[model samples]
Target: MSVVPAEVLPGGARAVTGTVRATVTAELGPRARLWPSLVAVYRAQLSRARVARIPLLFVATFQSVGILIMMRGVVDGGSEAESVVAGSAVLVVAFVALNLLAQYFGQLRASGGLDHYATLPVPPAAVVLGAAGAYASFTVPGTLVTAVFGCVLFGLPLTHLWVLAAVIPLAGAALSGLGAAFGLLAPRPELATVLGQLGMSAALLLGVLPPDRMPEAVRFARDLLPSTYGVEAFARTFGADPDWALVLGDLAVCAGVGVVSLAVATWAYRRAAVR
Candidate 1:
């Protein structure tokens, strides 16, 4: 029998191919760190959302403004007015962060977008947090406008309006994570949209209306909703002698819920990406 060259042997060819693949992989560099990946994803999502969601942002602002106008008739002033204003401002956050984000991820899932994200070297948490942060950031302008307009309409003090600096991100984190979970967990895009709408409605009814006006059962339900803490924290600031302790407590609770919800969303994202 004739001796074959090593290059022509099957095992040698396999080894050569493996070596080439390894070299190529090494040249590609290490996987990205979480912070850099997060920032890059955030920038991409922000730009895309800016162009595509501007109309929805308008709708959110207009919707909040309209609610304030309607409630102005029923609630002249006082704590009830504060509730309406605060809840409505936070509602803008809910509309985009909770409602729109659900729709976005739902569509992404339906369209094989998760596969694209999975192909990237970024951490799953980076993807979830980045998208959530981008959507949440959109709420800032609409939220501020609603708060300022509502304060004027309700004759509430503008002094503590600055508290929203804390309120928006905390509340947005909670709501955005919830929205992302809803979207990723839903079996269908339609179901995701429905869940988002229902969430927003809950915020509208339970958060905007004063807790005192609710029945015991409804009040309990409101307490379960994360956005209520944000509404309460913000509404308290309108008081002449605002309870800083209570406000901080509410904010702390909101922050805690945000962390929990975001962790859940990250879990949901990982689960969905695998499929």
Candidate 2:
């Protein structure tokens, strides 16, 4: 019997074995911490979103502005004006955080983009939160512009506009998570787009239109919508003697809903990624 050298056991055998070992080692490697992974993903998504930032900002601003203009005829001032302005501002948030995000993740999943993320040593929660945060960040400019413009158009007090500081993130977090969940859970990309559009339309109708104008049943539906609380919180601040307590309560509801929605989104991400 002839003894064969280990290196010559088979053609390319050692190289193949080494490659397999490397792959397994990589697969078994420790993942980056959640916060770092979140930051990295946020940066990457932010960069990607920047490419189309102009159109998105334009659409968000223009849509809100146009709504304000139309409402100008019907609503002269007072609580009606407050609702319109606040609703329009949050509408910008809904456009980016809810609408665009849904489309993005839907496309991502449909194109097998989740596979790329799955290969990375990153937590699934980070992926969901990072994407949501990136999208939410885009809402700021549009929301500010809308709020300022709506205030000018409706002649509402700008002193309380600072309330948006609390409103944006809370509303954005809630809506972004809902958008991400919608995208990941949808069976098809087209369905996700449709759902996103419908959601925005609901926000426009239920949020922008004064609750007083809505039927009792419709008002109840509006109450069920997460964005409504954010809108209410912002709207209340426009008053001369604003109720800080009520504003805080509304914001608290928004924060609570945000947590729930984001949790759902993380769950959806894990479910979708495995497929």
Candidate 3:
């Protein structure tokens, strides 16, 4: 018996009878079937992530409350508009960054989850998508909570609201990609946590604090953070103003990080131990 690869097309037709065609047709099956399968994989992966990250979620919730308390004091004396804008913008970035750190560590555990994917026939992109999806579920919702609290506490407007919603998920994707990339540089899980802390501290010193207040060198260093633009996006949303240039720039940075980090992650993952 001869084994030949055949790609079946719609209507009992064959799209490719040759060596497995490189082209994957998304339209081959009924449209409804593809998404649920992909989403199921994503959900399964996310469940593992969620299970491992209960402590992280608890900590983030506590941190969010603490920051809200701090911002309440700090936002005093500012105009209502300015207070909400400033508070929400800063907190949103912090929230997203923390979420990224949590998700990165979840993935970093070397817990054989990464290995399981290595054996699957599923595409690598699917793996990345699933992992990112799982993390996004955690991070994106927190931003909403942060935003609403900012609004109620500081009178931040939800005008141009869709932009606010968009920023969270966009930041989520970018941060998850960055997390995968950072995971490559960190060889150990503990090291990853330390590095994430140091990185966020740096981001906070630069983005949360005004640059004018920082020494030149410290301010200069803040330019390296991926969360800066996301913070700006949050601020812009509060103002109901769209900075198209900033949006494009953020999108480009996200694309660059996702592509480069995925490459590095894939290589590093190949070397990752799987039991």
List pairs with backbone clashes in candidate 3.
none
List the lowest-lDDT window of 10 residues for candidate 2: 18-27
Q: Which parts of model 1 are misplaced by more than 4 Å?
A: 1-28
Model 1's alpha-carbon lDDT is: 0.94
Better of 2 and 3 by lDDT: 2
Candidate 3 local distance difference test against the native: 0.56
Model 2 over residues 1-275: C-alpha lDDT tens digits?
67877778768464455445544334467868999999999999899889877697898899999999999999989999999999999999998999899998899899999999988889999999999999999899899999999998988889988889999999999999999999999999999999898888988899999898778999989999999999999999999999999999999999999999999999999999997
Candidates sorted on lDDT, descending? 1, 2, 3
Q: Given candidate 2, what's the lDDT at residue 241?
A: 97
Query: What would the C-alpha RMSD of candidate 2 be, to one decimal place?
Result: 5.6
For model 3, the superposed segments whose C-alpha errors exceed 4 Å read 1-38, 49-55, 77-113, 240-244, 271-275
lDDT (Cα) of model 2: 0.92
Best model number under lDDT: 1
**Candidate 3 lDDT tens digits, 183-221:** 544666666666556655655455555444568777567
Q: For each candidate, how many residue pairs have backbone atoms clashing (under 3 Å)?
A: 0, 0, 0
Shift of residue 41 alpha carbon in model 2, Å: 0.7
lDDT of each: 0.94, 0.92, 0.56
